[model samples]
Target: MNDNFLNSANAPYVAELFYKYSQEPNSVDSSWRNFFNSLNEDDLSVLGDFGGPEWKKRPSNIIDEISFDKTIRPAPHINIESFKSSTLDSIRALRLIRAYRVNGHLIANLDPLNISKKDYHLELDYKSYGLNDNDLNKEIFIDGSLGLEKAPLKEIIKILKETYSSSIGVEFLHIQSPEQKQWVQERIEEVRNKTIFTPEGKKAIYHRLVESELFEQYLDKKFLGTKRYGIEGGESMIPGIEQIVKQACIAGVENIFIGTAHRGRLTLLSTVLGMPYKSILSKFQGYLNDPNEVLGSGDVKYHLGVSSDREFEGKKIHISLVPNPSHLEAVDPVVMGKVRAKQTQL
Candidate 1:
């Protein structure tokens, strides 16, 4: 109820009982479950004296106030101080895990140029949760978090860094839907946000990269003074787009509508959208005329639109790249309208 009733002597036991109740409410007595359910976060602070020396010295005092199951009682051989320390460590570790899910993106290695400054968040540090180098090797009960029941603090930190603070950072805790948030968390944490490609897959990606880079090089040479936006530094996007298309088709997506500005548009068209290089080159050589013109006027090659069908693993998908004016993102509404119309037709 209060500090007077739940002091250092019984705090560890109560905390352990509360953790058990949290994991499985039916495991504890109905009375204890009801009492724990009634307690708010502020009220649970009475269990904060978990690792105090006095509590370790007076383990017998825990049994005086409440009758716990024999399974909840510490064995005679088990050290009370160690048990108390582990309980406190588990609580702190949970807070550290939560901090990663919420703010780890602030410290992620996302800047490819390495020019941007990243602030160090104290919340993501073990010291902020009352842990130090000495505690790193200590095992704590995480209750199946990150797919582990218990793990050393060092291993837990390593997993968290790989999952949340690596080059691919995530900030999904802000999602309003619990199911969606949980699904994302599970999916990311399951693979630690890293995708492993087979040898063949790696080769495919390499070939795509080569195609993108060579295409950019050819354009730069052929059109010396032309303002044809290129994808030189970011050629990896070609393979990335291919992966998106493959995954979408695998997921039963039948259509994809893309709208974009001039940057990398030609590269996407030639590489990802299956547009022939000869066709694109004809536009570059001024052999093609704008479809909208009655007098056969020329249009910028980048502003041309195309629709193509691609098949991946026996699944066929239609991809439509909407034409845009010089204004950025101008084709977004047109793409949306086309999508709505297609849905109505379906």
Candidate 2:
């Protein structure tokens, strides 16, 4: 047979048909004979029973011939080297995109300090993935539920960059469970199309920042050099904690416990938990000291915990701060134990 058209991809099936024909041509299936006849007519002219001398000269073990072709025949149209290169390129492209999704956070602008940026080789650019400008114009299919039926690669990259490089950084790829990883990805990706916050919401966030800033500045002026453990840089924590408490209340969570070291505890207490500003000021002035009450050396005013009963979305939430030692994260176990005990009581 002329391998110009008939190659190893079809060779095994052809060999099987030839063996059947050699046994009984008339009994052979019509499809098999028709398939053989479809090959170059001129080549079939000189060939005898099995269609070609090349096939007839092979061993009687037709299975062995098919096996040999499967093992040894170089497929005519397929460029093996090119196929391997293409496969490797595809693998690298997949890995490149995955790396961007996983480690883009390493280079993200999450720090409020606006610290010096570090380059993480997320390999976001198309050329890094062996793709070019032309490839960005080509449409590619994504998950159907994503609503974006099909999008250009460039659009996908833009969405990824916008999603990862923002103030929020996603770190879900390290999640072991496939379902959990997918769930996180879906939620994070939803940010791409998430409706913009209303004007009122923006105004509220702005007000919170201003409140945080002014409170810190006031303390700085009133009590100079006195470490009130300010929330100066982490002003966003005000709105963030507010949002969390609001959501927890809406979700019907009865209690919300926050634990933090000296960094911003006082500001959070005064602002979010609604601790009395005069009382906090009195503590700073050493006028709020409990002279009668004693239990060894007491913690700093900022290290003291406070609880408040706040109503949100028509739900009552008991928000409490677990007093933390100067050692960072020391309150975590204490908070956890208290939470479990509370849950037991409930």
Candidate 3:
């Protein structure tokens, strides 16, 4: 595989295929039919498979090899490196490599998701640009508190930036909303701990910029903690989930069958199901304080099933959040089955 050939793109070929096939949602869009039919025999041959898949091997004659991939030329297996025996033969091989360079290029470009980007955000961070223990106050950690919250902004920034420098998005949010809250919105926006971590800073990785010191500066800052799966920061999504969860609770059904992946589990847990933060916190701290508390077998922080009773309209509804497997659509079928089973009982 000549690197040059790999540089060529397969987009044009793929676009052609898509354009020809897209019309098939109805019958076949007959527009391109006659246009492709007008090709000469040799040109038409290019549309067919070159012959077999084995010909991509570097060939002594470059022309023959690429021709083989494109089905343009018949393949004969001779040592490609051996073809370098003569200068003229080597040049011929180079030509073949160049000819179908676009073929390899096109195949790589076939990925619609990463069509334009080179290398695709490759994690080239060979330098583990982070802080070392000696750089921090180890004594501060002895009080049973993770000093990470108090670490200087520079240090914090270096650690997290290097850690997630190339990460497409923030991955986690350990949230525990309080029970009584009129300003749920305001409370969710409250930074439990806030600091900006940037690699290019004073003293490299040595500083503390606490949220208390810097929070009020941004009165209008929006999307403070917005994430794909978070309840707040991305917090505006709580009310809707609370409605569904509340409905389930009042139904008084012995079992509540929930069937969501990880959209907004926290709000549901806190506001709807009334799951205690202590229970969620206990799991994270490696200790379930309640010995008999039966935690659902491994579900995500958001996917934990909850059981509770609430008053819906005039009736009592028992809400049971079901334990979810990692599989989303996977759990969908199971929910369907559960629903059917319930229907049968009725």
Candidate 4:
């Protein structure tokens, strides 16, 4: 709590102590609260001050800020003949009506995955299963006289499906007059093809329906659980991280610094840093355990940073991820500052 203890040498120790004691109600150590509460207004403002690299790129003042338009302006819709008997303005109004009817549209309207092999079925393979491509043939249209989204296409399909489902194992609905319901349902049955997916989709669909692909299939292979938090939704994004990185690197940045936490580090380390999987595993299993190792003490195995250079648009772009405090999102502006500094350097 003293000046000597607040030095760089003791900062890390204090950080850990603050983190640990914070878990207990009475253990928050009063000196920390006293230190924070004692900061002057000037000290506080300096601590929070931020922004301005390309600040010239921002608005000049509060009045210059762009805001969403909240005002509603509506013109009257008058019939042409009814509007015509008055003045020249009325004739103009008639012209407006004629033009509006011709173009304004008194509209009744409605509007409307690659898994890789790890036993991944190519989307092409699911052609026979009616589940995944079933709606492809239908013309999706709707009524809007009552307003928009009167009934979504999916709900309409659901209504039609339930109207006559003795087959495909869809449960039947209970109605007051079954025969009357059956008559309306019979017409729906003629148009609705239950085949939504292709044959391959149907196969995967059935496999899922029957629960055929269980944990036991890999039983012989001896599975250890997967860490599924990220490669995100290429874990089916297709050509994968290379495509993602290539897309992200297009902005005119000389060096890119990213700091995401436990999320994508392993994949990035392997793909970006060329980190050996063996080394990653060693860290995960604590095979590299040495209490005296000081740099990244008490952090998750995947929470370390890496550096590399990539060729973006024929320019060599350097990339590094900063080692962060336990605060994940708090490092975002820090990354921005570093990116701006790199730009200035260029």
Candidate 5:
């Protein structure tokens, strides 16, 4: 009747003996058989409290809560040993999952050049959760945390790595809104934060990259000595901005105001804002001799703002890039002002 007999140290051995006694009474010693036969439903229910507070709160009849494989679940009654083992595994596995969600970004491969070494955190390791290689193959009940109800520790770890520690690391736990945080977690974990593009989509991205590179190359060749502040290495932003425009249009957004410094401004103006290449070339060639001929208050070529309408899949959206001076990030408030003015007009 003493609950201390079923402590963590000997619970597995006792459960094993009880299972053997249930299968064939002669398989275990007489004392073990007698002990097993003396156990009632109440004693069996006590096994639910084996793990931690989470397990302690589980219903006394844990047989319905946990799904056991045929090999582990005995004929007439549940195998208490298997249940205890799985419960402990589930607790450790849950802790591992939470650790990755919180600290997995510490070791993400975010640096494209790989110049800086990543500081790996101990919590991201399986050993930190008291798990070993032997437990990796064991299945644990996760209650659909990562779109899976029950998964092996190895599979869970694989999904966690793919979702949290890949090239794109997400840190959304700091979000104050519970709904927004859960939404972001579910959205990324469901697809492992991978976006699969179709053949046409791939081709479109390739085309954008080619356009961006060609524009930069043309500027470099045309005005050899001029300081253009070109977007040489960061050409991907052209396609990224295009995709943002398309997605925004799809989401009922009709206007987008942008602000950026000299870097990549010409490329964005020509490619994303639909500014004519001839116009940009004319300005670079010093064709604007008179002050009145220059656009946007007679500013330099890159400091000039442009407005254009772009259509994606029949949905039209107007984009406006606010001009900025030599000071970095000076146009942010101007862009916000334009957005506020547009909102007022709407």
Candidate 6:
């Protein structure tokens, strides 16, 4: 190759050729070997003109500088403190919002003996994460009416606690869509701020609570050791479901389908869905009124579902409790399919 090509755009290729020739000169073309030998002699003369020992070190130093410039030296500077603060903020937000998902399982081993309250500090620890009260003063964004603008971090944390740490803790932050997250945030915040329950509403809640307690007491006395799978611990489900049904009716939903396992089904059927007390009691007495109407013997009364068209807030809404087998979560797909069919019909 011509020496001029070494100084042209093909310097890298010539350098590679020289490297190969240095490794095995006999393997290279005779002309190329002669050219390389001439270049090597000229290089030795130049090195001799400059002091040989110092110039010998210069090649290694130049290679080091070239490697540094080409590969290692020009990294963009990052602010370590700012990066740390941002990471802490993300972790804190997850703790405040997403921790409820794991801690708030409906049938968790929270109070196995039903004695003491369960502790849930896995993600709620601030000191463990090197955060203090001073960190709360930093501004952060929440999905609220404020949009992209930030509020004090302390205020956001307070709102999260109030929104999430109630008797019924929620875990909606795992939802992916921004609009859905914002909707949940807005609704939670609304419920938090609108804390006033009307006198009639309070009375209704009390009535449901009393009725639930009385029903459990009656069944305990009448049945005596028979496994009703009673809603003794979860009496609040009665009033809670009433609120849901009321909300659904208010939202102009014409149909509501519920699918749950045996837990709390009897009380829900009788009290909320308006199944007759006599009918439920008749089933408990081992009598099947319409055995031949349905297929394959029958499920237990608790596993059976009831339907009703009820008037809520002066709106007629049809509600169906989809029957579930002894197996948990089996009715979920059945309920969903029914809901999809109803929606398609609508």
- Top model by lDDT, which number? 1
lDDT of 6 at 330: 77
lDDT of 2 by residue, 1-346 (tens): 2212232233333455455555665545565455445544322322222222332232344345444332233346655444333323333334444656667677677666777775455365557655677666655433222335345667766776677656667777777776677667667778752437899989988988898898889989999999678887788888989988888889999898888878778889887898888878877777755664232475567777889988987899999898778786778999999999899999
Q: What lDDT is reached at residue 70 by model 5?
A: 25
> Residue-wise lDDT of candidate 6 within 185-263, one digit each (tens)?
5676676523578999999999999988888889889999877788888998899999989888989988999998687
Using all chains and alpha carbons, the TM-scores for the candidates as numbered come to 0.78, 0.67, 0.30, 0.32, 0.76, 0.56
Q: Tell me model 1's lDDT, rounded to 2 decimals.
A: 0.75
Model 3: what TM-score?
A: 0.30
The sequence of per-residue lDDT tens digits that candidate 1 reaches over residues 174-218 is 887767887798899899989989999999999999888889889
Better of 4 and 5 by TM-score: 5
| Tens-digit lDDT track of model 3 for 1-346 | 2211110122122223323334342222343344334444432333321211122211233323231122111113423232212212112222222222212222223334664643322122211212234433321111001122123323432333323322222222222432222133123223322335457543322221222112212311432443325433433344445455555556555456667667656445655567775675555445766676555565445456677776766777666566565676777777778878987897
lDDT, candidate 2, residue 336?
91
lDDT score of residue 341 within candidate 2: 89
User: Which pairs clash (backbone N, Cα, C closer than 3 Å) in model 2?
Assistant: none
lDDT of each: 0.75, 0.63, 0.37, 0.39, 0.73, 0.60
RMSD to the true structure for each prediction, in A, is: 8.9, 14.6, 23.3, 29.0, 9.9, 19.8
Candidate 5 C-alpha lDDT tens digits along 1-346: 3211223334344444555556677776565455556545534433222332231232334433444332333334435545445555655676778778888888888998999877477889988767899877767666456777678789999999999998988888787776777778878998999999999999999999999899899889979978888998888999999999999998889999998879899999998999988888888887864577656554677787789999988889999887778786767787888889989999
Clashes within 3 Å, all models in order: 0, 0, 22, 24, 0, 0
Score candidate 6 by lDDT: 0.60
Q: Pick the candidate with the highest TM-score.
A: 1
